[model samples]
Target: MKNLYFLALLIGFNLSAQELPNLNLLNLEGKSVSLKNDFMEKDKIYVFSFWATWCGPCINELEEMNELQEEWKKEINIEIIAVSIDDSRTQKRVKPLVKGKEWNYNVLLDTNQDFKRAMSIVNPPYTIVVKNGKIVHIQNGYVPGNEKDLYEKIKTL
Candidate 1:
């Protein structure tokens, strides 16, 4: 009985230890914000989606995420922040393109790629699920129906 109780406690600690790490990044307004400070306080889940204007897959994911934003928010307090990894030369196109698409979620520009380096993301449409400021899951590349799995993950959290 004593060994069983100790084993249960160890398992519980191990499960909690799998929580995500806290990393800071800039918002669309160019303001630095700690990921934990922004997403963890209310115990809500947030999605940090890295993207670029020229990437077709990234664009598709953003569009789908936009369409499902309202529904997802209703079910869970999820914030899908689309971070544009456009370089200085292409950065000028971001605003116009985003404005044209009429995407409603929070958008940020990663002109210097600092955020990308911090996250160690090498591709566009890289999505990370953050809960209470910790990264719980990461997915690289995007597919047409990937948002469904994302929503399921968020719902369970």
Candidate 2:
């Protein structure tokens, strides 16, 4: 039932042309960055994967994407930004966990969930693909092979 509910949510949240929120979020190193200004490359696709330090599938999705990013970049102009939604309590674990995993993604700290609220994201492992400041695609959950589908979607943009 939980899976079904998540699926329903996922289907309902497939945003076609929503513009990204002009919100400033802190990166892991505590630098305030603007979502719109900092990531506005001419035609580059930015994959923002929202996750938390405690979510297993969230970690899995990022790990798989990390492994596949090199090959994907060879064929497309893309950047993956792993946005951590770990609030103040668990937020401290985020850095150590990221370091331990050795992920190469640009990590953004969404400590107050401003970005998540702006995006209306309900869960972790939620991914949004943005191009030219507009959200082109969104995936609400992670499965072992979902990275392939994400790659294919990015290719079409």
Question: What is the total number of backbone clashes in candidate 2?
Answer: 0
Clashing pairs in 1: 20-135
For residues 1-157, what per-residue lDDT tens digits would candidate 2 score against the true structure?
A: 9999998878657566588899999988899999989999989999999999999999999999999999999999999999999999999999999999999989999999999999998988899999999888889999999999999989999
User: Any runs in candidate 2 off by more than 4 Å, and if so which?
Assistant: 1-14
TM-score of each: 0.80, 0.90
Against the true structure, candidate 1 reaches a TM-score of: 0.80
Each model's lDDT = 0.80, 0.93
Candidate 1 stretches with Cα past 4 Å from truth are: 1-34
lDDT of 1 by residue, 28-107 (tens): 56688765566665677778889998999999999999999998888787788888899999988888888899998777
Worst 10 residues of 2 by lDDT: 8-17
TM-score of 2: 0.90
